[model samples]
Target: MVPLLVPLLLAATPPAPATPAPPRLDDAVPDTFSGVERVVAVGDVHGDVDALKEVLRLAGLLDDKGHWSGGKAHLVQTGDIPDRGEKTREAFELLMRLEGEAQAAGGRVHALLGNHEVMNMLGDLRYVSPGELASFADQATGPETSGSPRGFDGHRAAYGPTGRYGQWLRRHPAVVRIDDTLFVHGGVSPEVPAKTLAELNRWVRQDLFPGNPPGGAANPQGPLWFRGYALGEEQGAGLALDEVLKRFGAKRMVMGHTTDRDGKVRTRFGGKAVFIDTGLSTGYGRHLAALELRGGKVTALYREGRVELVTPVPPPLPIAPKQTVPRGQVSP
Candidate 1:
């Protein structure tokens, strides 16, 4: 009674109501930049600097310096921003710059996170030797063979290092949800909700990246790189479109991890999961592939010539020399 005597004359003013939690990413971010009519979704952009430049050139976004030249078109990169190529740094920088430039030009560059990005963060994939990560990496690419700034691979000396860009990409979003279409580098796990994607990003950014991985299965390693099933590969896990849709709150989905039959962008999942990885790196001398999403439909595939397909040959797993731990001697 004595402890509360001082407040007897005043009704306790309720502490200011806790501020409502900020809106979830989907609620806060516009699926589409307001007023943009169409969005261009590009496939895996491994360290193909020349190919990146060409793609941007085709979209009218880059000139000679790999700068933003697209005045009004949205550019959606379907992940694969690192590894398997040399100019990963240049490509990452150009894309980051274009993100702002595109927005300023009444357009936008949506940098969707892909599996390779995750691998790079975990030190799984290597863009170049540790010492050469900065200088020897590839720059922005478009198609076919790529070129360097001073016009030679030796110009790598002038390009500096990959540390600048590699670090920035580690925190990038693994997937970008544009309007009703989920722009992802890899396929959406059969039934992840849009909130789950946001949750994963928040967890990684806030927990996983700072020497604090929240959990293995629920961590960035799982969602960003998991492709346990194919679109119609009855042999393994089948894509559950209904569940995938429920997770993203979208009617359709567009992903670019696996490839299609003709090695060009093809629609699959009966309009549910669209496979856009046409293996552009294979150098089959075919048309570069892409997709145009409009009104919740894939609308069109942008390639039209015989192109190459990077038929992935899954690498053999490393085997211990002789099961060093000895059968059941392994620690429990």
Candidate 2:
């Protein structure tokens, strides 16, 4: 009987490991999307709604009435929609409205989280202007006194976890992959190269909630605050950049934390890194610059109909080779 049992156990196959379920589209952190004919990315509105609208119009994204006109083009706003200006509330409202409109038109509005957004969510109001605070007064009931606990308390309440904007903002990703390009508020740091996009986003989202430690989402070197790509040494930084791109399987990374020294949309690392924050906010005199990706080409679109081709960076060597997928096809 023992010999027979031994034979039966040896013949039985071991159970296969359970496969982890793919993230649901609604709850995915770094939302992976494909099949976009064009991509328009704007950086750091900083509460400057006028400049945002003008830039969108220049890119043929928004209509005269500020409606979604870019039929199937993807619109990516690289965070910092709040702070340093007075129209933060209005800026949020406009993006919120356009999000629905864009989707209905077969497009998408990917608004990645920036440091200022994280600050606001965590109760840091140093940059919250009086006008911005008053904008939400009517929506929330609170004392009207200035500098009091109740002052701007209404705004805070409206932007808290239970608030409309807060709920919407929570759903936004810290990093997103559209086609083969990566979009993030700040540059990715060395510590982040090992994590997958989904893991990176999941950690960030978890850190955003209250009572969490001050590392993942709030650290200076985190995705929302890291500037290594923008200010690092060429050779070393290029190596780090290669690792990040390889990890995410993206050809290029588009970011908006650091403004270009020349106040124009520019690329570094031979075009592996594109900086779109031309300081378009009124605080920066409304630079009115944006980055457009279409037909496998990158272009810098400026106010007054100025268009220039952005030079492409030579593909990094000895890492994962860049993969180019045809339109309407998803890359493996």
Which model scores highest in lDDT? 2
TM-score of each: 0.63, 0.82
Q: After superposition, how far is residue 86 of candidate 1 from its true place, in Å?
A: 1.8
Q: For candidate 2, lDDT tens digit of each residue in 275-309? A: 88888987876788888888678888876565656
Model 2 local distance difference test score: 0.81
Off by over 4 Å in 1: 1-35, 60-69, 126-163, 190-196, 204-208, 215-221, 228-239, 282-287, 295-332
Model 1 accuracy (lDDT, Cα): 0.56
Q: What C-alpha lDDT do the candidate models reach, one value each?
A: 0.56, 0.81
Candidate 1 global TM-score:
0.63
Q: Which stretches of candidate 2 lie over 4 Å from their true place?
A: 1-26, 142-151, 304-332
RMSD of candidate 1 to the truth, in angstroms, is 20.1
Model 2 error, position 286 (Å): 1.0
